[model samples]
Target: MSTLTRARRKLRAHPVAADAALAAGVLACMVAGSFAEPHGPEGIDWGVRTPDVLSLVLMTLAAAALAFRRRAPRTVLAVASGASVVESVTGDPRAPVAMCAVIALYTVAATTDRPTTWRIGLLTTTVLTGASMAAGPLPWYAQENLAIFAWTGIGATAGDAVRSRRAFVQAIRERAERAERTREEEARRRVAEERLRIARDLHDVVAHHIALVNVQAGVAAHVMDKRPDQAKEALAHVREASRSALGELRATVGLLRQSGDPEAPTEPAPGLDRLDELAGTFRSAGLPVEVARGDEGAGLPAAVDLAAYRIVQEALTNVRKHAGADARAEVSVVRVGPRIEITVLDDGAGQDQDHAPGGGHGLLGMRERVTALGGTLTTGPRYGGGFRVHAILPVTTRTSGARDGRP
Candidate 1:
């Protein structure tokens, strides 16, 4: 990396001592320059003054502070401003003594804000210039006083320009950082939304089909001792339900796996063609299930067919579970205009209905599934004393299109 980066990372590699030695050498030169001449004004003391040694010591201290000025600007400025005031009031030539003050002013302007620099710079210049003219052995309009004014102003102005540039760069960095954060947040939100959509699909498909399987298994075990033909039919229903569940589950899960990793297993989803076999499953379980079709042999979108089959299957299962043992259920599949309406009705008081149509997540899953296909679902107690579940699923499944909802 760069030298500054290496030095910042490793504290021991700093050049503080080397810089201090260099500043000391420069200070020595300035001290020597002050003693060489005193051309402060035309008629002022042109040679060395009486208090030259003390003035040299003060100027030397101010110049020494320059070594640490970059590290601690405020401290360096304080020392340099003090030194300038002393020299303007005591030294023959304000001379090289004001050099340290100029460096410190520049450091302050570059590091601090304009308002703070203005306040401190004006104060330093005012104190030093006024002190040199009012207390020094020179006239008020001496060249030394004019030189003090010019040098101090240069230090403050140059430092302020450097400060402005640094502030501008920092602002640009902050704006880029903010935009990056917003992009990351948007990406995270999209990921979460996709995951939820996948999960809802899994829950609806698995819960509906698996419940049918469980109900079929129970029926086979219960009637196996008495009715051989009915028990065999119940077992057949169990096989159909399990096989259907496994197929849908595999296809739904495959959509999520990475394409390059490995091939995803899939099985075709059941549609309206399976409706007769599904209705037979409930009839074989000792519950009377009657189906009447009014679709006129029309084919629906695969998603609509699947949603309609599940809605009817779940409703019939609830009838067998909650309705009285004597209850008879009706299943109707009808095409009404642009929608396919499939409804299940049981003539048993649902209060005794251990498996009402809207219990648990079955009905909720049905509603979500139908709605996703751009349809409507309504389930509740029938007006008199039964339960009814009606779902209107669209022939053209809207969710199948990418434009249905964009991530």
Candidate 2:
């Protein structure tokens, strides 16, 4: 960067040293000005005109006070103004002691509010000008008295402008920081929602297939020696169930892969169209599941279709695990007015499994899926025995079209 830019940055880094240097520079200028004649030959100024010892002492004191202007601005202004008044009243030819007061007034104006700057700046200007005009050898109309008024006013005006610019810059910086924080919070919220969605998908896939595999594996172990053919068939079902589970798992986890990875499987997500296939898998595992539908050929929104399929899959999986072996499940899909309804009823000898150990998250996941699609789900014990799950999903093209619009 430029040399001037580097020097300013260094000064800002060491405020005390910077202020000390300012005080020294002001002292040098005032000391040099003290000797210059205010008026010379032909009504102009020249040569050196030395001030009395008291004026010199006051000038020195005023410049020194400027070193701490930033630390105590009001106190420094008071000291500097007092020194200028003393020089104005007592000196034969007034020294440029008021230069130091002007600097102090600028510091006060820059640090304090506008009202205080006005009060202090006016008081200093009045006192110094009045003193020089009334008590000095020069008359009230002397150019020196007028110069004092002008310089002090310039100091206050310049200082106030600098303060306003600093405030404006600070406000802009705070607004930018607040916008950055809001963006970060929005990103985090989206990430959390995506994680929950993936988690629910994984749960549904694993729970359904694993339960079937467990059942088929148990059958193979029980009949391995007594019925070789039946054991082979059971083992084949286990292998098929496991392969399907892996395929679904790979598809689900593929969503989390980086862009550089191999392409994911193009197989379409399962829906009600696969309901019979899903039921067949349960039948092979010894849970008799029957599906009935009155919706006919009506197309569903992609989200509603997926939700309905998963609800059925999860409900049947629960029935196979918790319902008695003799229990049978009936799943029905019906178009009722403006909504599609799905009901799964099981005659299994199982109690309310919602509060049972290891059964909590299934119902909650179902509820979340239904709610996310702006649908409603109810699950509880049936009138006589077993469990029931009923869900009502909107069938409007508008709802489905909205879901289609999302990534």
Candidate 3:
């Protein structure tokens, strides 16, 4: 920083030192003004007469009181005002001691409220002006008496204005800071929602396609020599599933791409309308999947549709991966009075069927999607020999998105 700026900061940091310097300046001005005679024979003349000992003593006391103006403004004002009143009554020329009182009044006004400023300011002006008019060597209507009134009023007015400006700037700074905090919170919320949506998309895509690829690759390996044609068909299914997995992964990850990068696929998100195709993929992979729909002609919101599709896909993927070689899966969708209910069950007696699948994200992803849509899910071991997954989704979501209210 520059020299002047550094000096101002130091002065503000040590206000009493700054006030002492101000007191010294006021003392110099008072001593100098006491020597001047405005009504001299040749206009205003300097060094016409020196102040009396009593005037000098009062001037010194008034200036010294100003050194503590900021520490105790009202007390300093009272001291300075008393000294100026004594000088106005006792000194012949009234050595400009009221200047210190004016400075003290300004300090009082700046540090206090408007009502206090007005009360203290008016009282100081009246006492000093009345003392000079009624008891001084000068006449009651002299300009010196009126000047005390004008100067004190100016000090009070200027100090109040400065206080008002300081308050205004502080208020604006607080408002901007509050707005900045709100923007940061909103941005973080949006980021969290987007992350959840991407996670759900990735889980659904990988769980469904990887399960199919794993099944097909195992079949191709088991029958490679005995049934070459069947093995080749299984390899072809593996290729298709792999390709589908890549496409879905690209679409989900593309959400994080920068603006200048290649655009992601514009294919609409899967919904219950694609239930037959979803089931066919599992059926071809050696699992029997039966899908029944009771909401054939019902229209569903986009978020609800996507969430429903993901729930079914995850549930079936779990069944295929954990529900042994002879597993049979069934899915049902029904619309009932402002809600869409989905149920997926499997008659698989696989050992892993009783436990969580894929580190538990499958079930958790399904639950997150359902909860985001103001829905409920129930998943547990079946009564006899299988596992059951059921979810109820709102036809119209409370929020605006499928995964946590982000479009």
Per-residue alpha-carbon lDDT of candidate 2 for residues 179-242, written as tens digits (9 for 90 to 100): 9999999999999989999999999999999999999999999999999999999999999999
Each candidate structure's count of clashing pairs: 5, 2, 0
Against the true structure, candidate 2 reaches a TM-score of: 0.87
| Candidates 1 and 2 compared by lDDT, better number | 2
* Best by the TM-score measure: 2
Candidate no. 1 TM-score: 0.64
The candidate, 1 or 3, that scores higher on TM-score is: 3
Model 3: lDDT to the true structure: 0.89
Off by over 4 Å in 3: 1-17, 38-45, 115-119, 122-143, 350-358, 398-407
Full candidate order by lDDT, most accurate first:
3, 2, 1
Please state every model's RMSD to the true fold in angstroms: 6.6, 3.2, 3.9
Q: What's the true lDDT of residue 209 in model 2?
A: 95
Residues 1-407 of candidate 3: C-alpha lDDT, one tens digit per residue: 99999999999999889999999999999999999998899988998888889989988999999899988999999999999888888768548888988898999999988999999889988898999999998999999999999999999999998889989999999999999999999999999999988988998998799889999999999999999999999999999999989988987787788989998778777889999999999999998998899999998888899989989899999888887889999999999998999999999986443354435788888889888888999998788888899999989775544455555
Off by over 4 Å in 2: 1-10, 41-44, 126-142, 336-338, 394-407
Candidate 1 residues 150-185, lDDT tens each? 888988999899899889999989989999998999
